[model samples]
Target: MEFTITNVILLFAVLLVIAVITTKFSSRLGLPSLVFFIAVGMALNHYIYFDNAYLAQLFGILALIVILFEGGLTTKWCHVRKVLLPSASLATIGVIATTLIIGFFATYILELEWLEGMMFGAIVGSTDAAAIFAVLGNKNIRTKLKATLEAESGSNDPMAIFLTVSFITLIQSHEMNFLSLVLSFFWEMGIGLVLGLLWGKVAVWMINKINLDSSGLYPVLSLALAVLTYSTVSFVHASGLLAVYVMAIFVGNSDLTYRTSIIRFNEGFGWMMHILMFILLGLLVFPNQLVSIAWQGMALALLLMFVARPIGVFLSMMFMKYSFQEKVFISWAGLRGAVPIVLATFPLIAGLEHSQMIFNVVFFVVFTSALFQGATISVLAQKLGFTGETKAPAPYSLELVSIGRTNSEIVEMTIEEGSAVVGKELRELELPEDTLITAIIRGNKIVTPRGTTSLQAGDILYVLVTKAQRETAKQIILEG
Candidate 1:
């Protein structure tokens, strides 16, 4: 196969088509699409050779920025607020605990030195936001549980990243300065948080004030800002991934022009990054190399899954209100994904003596975690009685597009049985000033709402209201 520009593009298109088709079937089979993506990449390696650790690491970092930002952008502040403290605890303390436990096990079981074991542990310690978001896609789990998992996964990468970098530095220098380590940790986290919030506000202001000529350009603007935020934060020696995620949350929650379009664009782009990163990573792995470490990899993975993860979760949430089953489920959901594999490449790039061995082990661990844990998450939720009823998506849709800043936006809500406004006409509900019911969806029909349109159970309402009046309007219609 000649690797000309046209031939390369043709190959890329074919891979994407295969990936999309594989995702559709993976959903039906209750498996994560990442598995198939990696399979595709590994299959391609037979014809096209690729093994550049530095390039893979660079691409992985970029993909993570988009993936993390998208996760934060779509997260609802209302849902995350209640679980914020617990999630933070899990992301920081829980990650540390998991690392230490796994590190100890690796030293004895895997017969590695203490530092090497800790480095290996740090590489795989945190739950992957990409895996969590992909696997838990509208699974109807308890709201708080889902929020905790999502928030923790989205935020925990900083701690793991910090630990991995610190260990690698220490290994290279053969020096252990505890005070410097502590200070560095604080510096990275503090700067990342401060800059994330500040940059997010600035980004939101830019989006609303610039008023781009074309609606399509709004998403492009957002994409540019996201990359800018990550790079800017990273240049200051801070956690760029953390900064990007925080900035995205701010932008996503704010009222701005084309907010919906921006989010949708990032969501689609994030999926593309996921597929590309996984496939590229798959191409880097050698099946024969993985087989050599199979026993050690399986042992460490089991230890992390059965022992380290459960202890970490329980300790982190001991003072919280989660039930025992919820805690167990949270432990089970500590899925490893692209992050660990990407982190593994760090060692290789650093030229560590056992870097290849570490990469292979980490890859195997992530593969096992994603396959076993990702596949059975829903079934476990059912058994634990944590599943909740999810409203079916409306067949009809409504979107609000603005070329300039607007305080008012569209909100969608479903009417449940015995709602206060049920059996009442739209005009009779006494909605807040300037509130307008745009459309009422009943069964298969989209009804343009009017004074004479009576609300009924199972109706989906799309209303336009100012940000300040949103809660008041919800109270009138939903709790009436």
Candidate 2:
């Protein structure tokens, strides 16, 4: 039955309510709510559907845009800079290596044809930044390792998308002309890079130039630009994900008048996207079909976990000074999520043979990744001895004053493992004159202030300080 406009709105309303309830249940069960969201989607498909695959895909794209944009916005330039070289190299090189290495294993061990085996490899190469940020955003891990994971997840998807689409094309045409393939891949990525940077610069200029007084309207404007950037870049055969991410990052880190509102809007949108993507993809999966390939998927997943991911991490970062534990976390951090499954849809839509099998294998890989990696990241972080502070960002505040001319300040502090402030009252700490710990986002909770506030490590503080006494204020906070 076709859903009318009223029905569509009602359906979404019902889904949202269910999402909140399901997430609550999943949290109590020690699981990622994403799994329950997938189950909800499958259940809905049994009794109801959107009546259009295109609609499902449309929602998927919207979700990815929000997810990537939020990631870009939250990504700190300094955090990524420290592990920049390793992270960038891992995203690029590790993606390629995992694909080919797993490809060969599929061909030899699974006794599949070369093309199909490569298809499986290509499907699983990239890590999902959405999943990483969703799970790890709340953890208290070291800054360096977290940066490495976040940056890798943020950048690797485009490369994996490139590889998957490229392999699909090769399978259809039976042509693997090496030079053409290499050139085309580089060209596409190059276009995405150039276009993304260009679009971001232009968008920011327009945003800052147009003095929009309505804080609410500014988020709408930026979001419109984000969608436009994706469409325009993809229409020209560039990476839409790349373009949206860059545009969002530029808009996010810039001095916009309504930066807080914009960030809030995008963050909410990102969550909705995640829920929608997982649910729709889950509906596409047939649990019965997955059983037949159970062993095959398990074997391939084991190879990826035990062999491909770790070797890629160690080899790529051999020159780096990462400890053994950091290396293990790096390997474990290569968790796949909805991106590979989303890419799996490509082969099916194109009517490739064994596409369903490909989809199921992709499903298995993603499932194991989320199940294993998501559950153990915090414990692994502690075990690895890189227990560096990962202070979450403080609550966002909006003000109209010019920060440069005014006496307002931004003070930075690191929370130690055993500081007195760990469980003390903020009032007792005697925070200095006119300084507000405006935001105290522990994990993802933006803590509202009171006299009984207890500080925790990995909590980012956006302190509004006195410009003249900013240095002195930093000393007081850090010392305490």
The numbered model that scores best in TM-score is 1
lDDT tens per residue, model 2, 356-375: 67777878877877777766
TM-score of each: 0.89, 0.79
True-structure RMSD for candidate 1:
3.9
For candidate 1, give the lDDT. Answer: 0.87
Model 2 has an lDDT value of 0.75
Whole-model Cα lDDT of every candidate shown, in order:
0.87, 0.75
Instruction: Compose the digit string of candidate 1's lDDT tens values, residues 151-180.
Output: 999899999999999999999999999999
Query: Judged by lDDT, which candidate is best?
Result: 1
Candidate 2 Cα errors over 4 Å, as ranges: 1-8, 24-30, 49-55, 108-111, 388-480
Instruction: Score candidate 1 by TM-score against the native.
Output: 0.89
Candidate 1 lDDT for residue 447: 90
lDDT score, candidate 1, position 141: 84
Error of 1 at 426 (Å): 7.9
Cα RMSD, each candidate: 3.9, 7.2
